[model samples]
Target: MATKFKPFDVVIARYLLKPNEVFHLSKPLMYGAKINTGFGSINHDDIIGKPLRSIVFGDKDKKHKYIVTRARLPEYVINVKREAQPIYPVDASLIVQAADINVSYPTLKSVDDTEIYKEIDIFRRRGYKLAKNKRNDIKNDSSSINKKEEIIQEKLLILHGPINSYNGKTITRCSTPPLQFLECGTGHGSLTLQICKSIHASNCYFDGINDLSRGSIIHSLDRNLKHMKIGISTVSGFQKGIYLDDVEFHYEPIGPSNWVNSDIANYYRQLCDTTEFLQGCFLDMPSPEHEFTELSKYLTVDGFIIVFTPSISQIWDCYTFVKDNDLKLTLVSTFELLTGGNGGMREWDVRRVMIRNSEMVGKVVKPRIGVRIVGGGFIGIFRKIP
Candidate 1:
């Protein structure tokens, strides 16, 4: 019979030599008869002692040429610059034991591009409906959505106010300043704008990214920042914005690639950079394997990352990626809060997706729907250490 599908912690225990550190065995180590461990044992002695290179010859071809074929790459030569300290606290005796092995949040089909457009139209109509009633103080006359404060309130409604005053308080508790930070999948720039506003309030400069379109993140950022009484310096593109601060944040595009010229790439070069965060939504989806590697590069020694995704599979993938790469888990939250308003469609889209994917019952509509999602959304957070 096949081995049982063990829990993540158990599976992790087998591969890790220390907390948050995985034992990516050298060819020599893999052949050891008994893999030593604090909890249990493993045996693969048959392959021990022989240099891994000797295997290709078998019994007959001892004289075969050891040609370094380009197709068959040689084992990597990883040079350790110096002895490194433990990235995370490792108590060999303790392990991550939990009743639940994994939690999955499913992706929903309710809010595709057409649905998104429909919702946007509905949201815009709601604003006009509210403005016609002269319901609240019309603050900030910048552009079309000049009454931004009212728009913010309305947009929150669209999100069903899941991110109400209480949710904001909860998220704000752990939302500390980092040397650098990132907000990914920034759609209409709502969360990006909020984060930017908060960072500005702290007099800190952070970097964020959203895919550009005819009227997308850039448009949203432009509209929303205009509402702020403070002077918010907005720039164009990831490469240009790196100088925003010594520390910054990165939000990935819809796809991932090995080519490393993103906002996070530049931030990695800074000496003082310590903390980083990774956020995702519909606009931020990338192949899971690729995203994890992209995220790992930006992390610092004892750095932390916060990831937001709509699917439980994505969350687990992110968690495993972080763990296998020697990252730590600081906090996790499924509950997201948002006050509906204009200039934040991407934020609203995430909420909409989460509501659709999860079984959680959305709060009743308040005042009216400022931010509307056909269903709820999902989010997760993770940390990294060097």
Candidate 2:
């Protein structure tokens, strides 16, 4: 299989996950996607030695530090002694998912009982046909990701509490690949904090902004992530949380419904002040459609934006607003990463439709949630189109 598949090759398949498969691992299922794992690198050591979650997401301590406290050495050994500090222990759970391979009756028996094994084996061969037949039925299911945008609209029907409160999503951002971005929307701050740790682990820097600074979402997030150290190559949990290199939130009032204040001078000013190229803005300013136009002005052509809203209609409305304003626009991508009920189902729609999608003076890319943040949002990649 190693020789057949080769290294650096790309393969795709829908892998079914068993809970025990990821036991003692980080995540239960590792999607054999672009970044999760490499090609031709699958082996027992690669596969079975460590749990999938740990391999994919966990961190290891490798550096050696020294404490040079000058003291008397043994008789003539040396006046000054050199001692190396022991490596600190690091532990984390990781998840892995296998892909693109045939399974037989024997392989199925390894994980499940006789009755269950039989069902999966039947699906293995003829399941694709069954899926196609029931595609509509599968789609109509509330949890299905295949449903049309109307599902995003439908989730908004039961909005309650603070509009920006936890919508049951976890939003985290990472600069690296694979789980580089995730947005669970379960409203767990730890998910984002953990991802931030992972990004830092990759030796990358992070900065962020939130419109609702005092909101519980932020309060929980701040308390949880406050311990991370913000500068240079330092790692801190709550004990070592990074004081994000650049983070700020300001007031930008938006009228009811959709309206765009194209001349958003103040907003532009804040944008210019940031040193970090990547930033996340979770502001609920009205007319994001128009604000995007104004916001586009400041982006470095390749810069991207992540807008969270419960209204898919509003996102569509943005398309029309950009057109009417004579600002050339196109939607690069749009998809719902998660849905929730507290503050309504939060929808993340990314549009790369820029000053002109094709020939970019600068372009935008919609972000996919990398990890969950406190306020039911995800972090994604966006570049300043240059």
Candidate 3:
């Protein structure tokens, strides 16, 4: 006999008051498995046949109720246990947008393009006529239709969490073109997951190769084995429903000076010689300044480098290093909080710098301030100049 599936057979129970405590279970609720809210125990049977969005009260406490609903990624992210501070959703959204982690839809080549010609012929056969007022209405509606089309053309896949931190922002900005990305300090792997998501969303896969040697890959290096394990677990949890196989974790510590000695470094060198170049890198160590020279060797001309530091003094050190090296300081931005509480104020200082590319003279774009203020951090962006 085949099993029959019914609506509301399985449901995710969300505490109406707490919003954080959520439980997922199948229908024909197991009698022994009951979720305990602070107020009381919620029996699985109470929710098994209830429709999604229905409110069910706790068995012991009538005052306590749970908002039955399906589990979502953002909710899961918030409720998931984390060892390190994860990047907030607002910051992640900004990072994705600023870094242009978007896929562009293909465009028709010419008026004679097959799809275009077919559409035109259909319109001609319809012989549709519009009254003067109706034509004006259609003209107004065209703008809205175009807007809808634009929205469809650009799809934003965003996951909310505290995964992307200040360092994450720098990594996202530098890792444009989704080439080779190196993260010196993995922390809790919050940023690692974000990087993996970006690489996957950008569709930066190694063509004809499934190994780490091809396409865009992230080398996450950390010294502490425990932290590395935690980071890996965190990333694995994030990748549960999503596909992000380009990220590799390493336990060895990487400094700008000795990175070449590492096995991954040799792999990257081979990749550089054959197919692609190191496009971007992020350094978040105690002394990121020391690794600049070593990073330069691996980075391609016109590549991006970003360094994160909490101290304003470190920013000065990085600025001086960029000036002395064969790189151009493009932007120096610091995130700050303007408001507090649930919906808080967040802002960042954006500094524009100029660097010569090809025969074109260097030009600095005007700096602007970010409107939202979630939290504060500092980032320095540099471009590798040949």
Worst 10 residues of 2 by lDDT: 91-100
Q: Write the per-residue lDDT of candidate 2 for residues 223-327, one digit (tens) a residue.
A: 112121121112111221342211111111232111113122222222223322122222222445545554454443433444434445555566556656765
In candidate 2 the C-alpha lDDT for residue 177 amounts to 16
Error (Å) of candidate 1 at residue 348 is: 22
- The whole-model lDDT of each prediction reads 0.27, 0.26, 0.48
On TM-score, the leading prediction is 3
Task: Name the Cα RMSD for model 2.
Answer: 25.4
Q: If the candidates were sorted by their lDDT against the true structure, best first, what order would they fall in?
A: 3, 1, 2
Q: Which candidate would rank higher by TM-score, 1 or 3?
A: 3
The regions of model 3 sitting more than 4 angstroms off are: 1-13, 17-36, 41-63, 68-78, 92-178, 202-209, 212-215, 239-243, 254-257, 272-276, 325-374
lDDT of 3 by residue, 107-131 (tens): 2112222432222111100111112
Superposed Cα deviation of residue 60, candidate 3 (Å): 5.9
lDDT of 1 by residue, 253-349 (tens): 2333331243223222221223232222112344343455565554444443444444545655655555566544333333222223221111122
- Mark the regions of model 2 whose C-alpha exceeds 4 Å error after superposition: 1-240, 243-246, 249-286, 338-386
TM-score against native, each model: 0.29, 0.27, 0.57
Q: In lDDT terms, which candidate is top?
A: 3
